[model samples]
Target: MRWLLLIWLILWGTGVEVRAQAMSRPKNLILMIADGCGPASITMARDYARAVLGRKELALDAIQVGAVRTGSVSSRVTDSAASATAYACGVKTYNGAIAVDTAGRPLATLLEAAKARGMATGLVVTSRITHATPAAFVAHVPRRAMESEIAVQMLDQRVDVLLGGGWAYFLPAAEGGRRADHRNLLREAEKAGYQVVRTAADFRNGVRRPVLGLFGPDHLPYEIDRNPQAVPSLAEMTRTAIALLKEDPEGFFLMVEGSRIDHAGHANDAAAHVLEVLAYDEAVAVALDFARRDGQTLVVSVADHEAGGLSLGRNVDGRGIYDWRPEVLARVQASHERLIPALRQSDRPDSLLRAWLGLDSLRAEEQALVRQATVKPDRWPVVLTELIGRRAVVGWTTNGHTAVDVNLYAFGPGAERLVGSFENDELGRLLAELMGFDLSSLTTTLRQQQPVGESR
Candidate 1:
């Protein structure tokens, strides 16, 4: 066994292709996407894990193969919609396109192809089930903002397992949903033979096919603010999805996303970002464990794009600080978004910060900033993050996506196919090849089934 492993490593390092006959195609595929995680994000998480949690390394540390270039057809930086579409369809499209080509024509995605081949398919995410990354796999709309339409199409696809938030998009306005179309998709889902679940308890108890688990009305709570009793964590959802999908004899395809790491990055909250990445790593561990046990499974984890331009070391007041303090972030108990609301309602806002941020005492300037932001609601998050970030010695260049390349990790069968740096679309094509799915033929058939000029 050691000799065979050494031979495999030698072949991989030397760029010598092993014959197809010598390799077995994976019977199951698990694709995990960290929506806006980047190299710096991983470093921050690792530092926190080692310094505070006393862990040696992350689950992803052992399986990292290479990096992936994240750019869209329209710009060097990519958004969730186009970047996810690149992975789902193996094609480049505009920034807002969802599983559509640059021409606004619907394209077949890997999930669709897997379903066509009689495999069970599932999507698990921390974002709304109708959000960009997950939507790219099961629904094709011209715009990512058309979440109502996206929700309709997801049910039409009949994905075996659907787990996430965005229950509002599935119901009508009269029924406390955001939809103006007056369609109760929850009822529609029930009529279609789906077991709709809404709480962590119900989700755990469920053992049926075609399960739709919407734990919240919008995106699920950030890990810093998550209630384990009310909402299932990303790892829990991934474990459940695997349990349901692996029952299929033909094979299965599942996409699991750590959706809100991007949200924390956009807020430039180092404390929140650290917790989100740790949550995502936990989910990665779940996938890796299942893959290790089920040798016929292929597990690939990658980020679509980097967000916030996160920097580990920061220069303070013209003084070059050569150190970062992850211990400061370890003291944070809630996300800044959660604190903003508390700030708005509390008359003694300083007391709120003292309790939640573990700040026993604040400097005069820090107290003043909180007072000013207390009066001005718009600056609430700004002051909160500023206080935390300065202590942590972390900085962010921009509150948006960056063109920087992101790391890729893979394990299980055919992981060798993704061992080198490449474009995001190229990675998509490789994924299809590893699964032995003809994406080009699938796309052609989809185009023929629906006329090119039809509404997307």
Candidate 2:
């Protein structure tokens, strides 16, 4: 009986490779990263979307599998650098390093491996391309602080498509930055067989080869504040990157990160966070639309962690808190741009009138009371920060990072392999297997046991 079971497991239907073999490796890999996303963050976004759409959103509804664990390599607690490293290099390293081992040894990123396998590679993010999360995939450093140096690493890797910000890191230090490089990355990339494009028009005009685009000096503008006439929305960025990468016949790996979602949450600005989340969801919709039509592509969406400890401050059902009308949320967000800016610059009620908001602008005396509004935040259901989220019916737990299990959503071929709980590092391994690269080929060893998410 034991031999029969072993035979079934090892040689089932000879034509079909069971276990890791049955599913054909992904020809195209689209990894959607929500920088500071956790289950709570996703749940909050989902509920917010449901209220406005009056139904399950197609972006999240395509989720066929969800995971429960998201720990970094060194400890139960993790930061973006460590977390991103987990996914960038299958083997886990210290908390602040990227694509390196615990002994401070640098390892090859999935992008480098994919490129070696004759696959095209691309990176897209709302954050700077040199940011820790994006850097993990192509840059090896002992510390994430080497962001500028890491920019050179990305350049050195010769990734087919590089989009996002961090131009400051690539420019000479005299230009108001710490970077030591004087070489123009865009020009260098072009010289090294990459076409450099910086505007929407660049994407509009089709290109015949790999392209490198830098849209901003640091991280790209937050989705809420980005001028549509200038920077492309997250969805547009995703769609354009896809079109470019898909042209490669050897298949491609594209990493699109919705970075500012976490940035907004980190600021404890609820309204901003909601907008960022929406922007990311729109990008997800773009990816799914492509995958659904392509049939051969595999799309995986997950977060590195959760930010601002976001959770409902007031239980809507328990406290009679009702969902904010979508229009109301939109108005609030627009209003705050003018309102909050003044609020941040003010100290008391005496200057309350300073707010450009049409609301009863507080007089000097009123400003005094308004300034006090931030007090006793723990006792109240709202605050200036909460006001941001409340307009969208979004709430938060605190204004800092927390240990939590982020979400994992997947679709298309090979997605079934992600149906169960796994660690953050395993995600890297899974991608390795899905891409037809033997995990060992990268020359990294990862624990076989799955890492569990904080939520579980």
Candidate 3:
């Protein structure tokens, strides 16, 4: 009987059932990245949703597959550029590298490979379209800060859908833009057959195959400070991108990034961070919904790295009395980005700071810190962030990235393969394999090509 069972197991492994499933590979891939989000970030956002939004849980929290260790070749603590490069190119490179190996050699990104296979590719981000995370997937540059070159490369790649900020980099410096060269990329994109949309209404109304939407001069505004008339929400962009990319018969690969979560974390603003996570989860919901209905789509949600080392706990006084002031989080009406600029422009910085932060409920020492922040121009952002964090019972270790594992949530076809923890670059390999591409062969091909900087 044991011998018969062994024979049955072997047959099942190579049977028609396994072969049929393997032949029906996923037709669409959606990678959702919440920049600077870690497990602690998710926990805080989950609790905040439970208390404030009155929702049972976020869409992302419901699909917890596992975690991934995020580290670059250069350091244990990874920056957004390096971590993004790992997933985009399936190689561990230096912290500042963008889609390039440690020696500044270019690597073929998943997007490039997908496009090469006749798949539609789309990038939807809350950051500038040429920002590090989005740029890594399409542009090969030695430094992530080369926005001008990145923008040129992105258009040259002919990405099917492009949405987000950083219109400044595409415009010429003569027109109040940042680019030193006088190349009008907006016009270039139009010549390349892309329908450029600058307003939310245009984004929602425009129906085009290759679309370009640039809503802000720099990065888009935080959710709390966003003007809906000017900037579209992350969820809106995800929906629009899906609608456009799903038309391709060859399938599609779309990357949606909640980029400002990293910015809020860098500021150590718990209120903004929680809101950004919630906003990102909304985009995740959109992808999950599509994947559920399509069945041939795989939706993977992950974070590049953890920033701020955020912790949520009860506040302690000098007398060692523990107090839980969850209601203090309710008083935050604006984000640090919104409040800081207002404070800087205000005639009475102290009054504006107190009102913006709701510091009436804060302790005397915290209130004193707020006053100091108002007076000291150089240290104002840090001190103000600390005051708000203290009031909300949020603690932060540093205003930088941390060497911590981040959560990975997935749904639909091919998600089970990502259920275990692994190195950051390994995730890229798994993704490429799922898409029926060998990342090793792609990297080998890139390495054999003329060195990136040399003329052919």
lDDT values of the candidates? Answer: 0.91, 0.71, 0.86
Question: lDDT tens digits, residues 1-456, model 3?
Answer: 999999999898779767866865789999999999988889887787888778899998778989999999999999999999989878899998989888888888889889878999999998988999999998888898888889998998899999999899999999867889899999989998999988888876765879899998899999877888878899989998998899899999999999999999999887888889999999999998888888999899999999998877634453332433445666677887777777767777766766776665556786677667667766777877667656666778888999999999988778878898979999998888888876667767867864676522
Arranged by lDDT with the best first, the candidates are: 1, 3, 2
Q: Pick the lDDT winner.
A: 1
- Flag the better candidate by TM-score, 1 or 2: 1
Candidate 1 Cα errors over 4 Å, as ranges: 1-22, 453-456
| C-alpha lDDT (0 to 100) for residue 58 of candidate 3 | 91
Query: How far is 140's C-alpha from truth in model 2 (Å)?
Result: 0.5
lDDT for 140 in candidate 3 is: 82
Give the Å shift of residue 286 in candidate 1: 0.8
Clashes of 1: 0
lDDT by residue (139-166, candidate 2, tens digit) is: 7777888876787778887888888877
Q: Write the per-residue lDDT of candidate 1 for residues 31-88, one digit (tens) a residue.
A: 9999899999999999999999999999999999999998999999999999999999
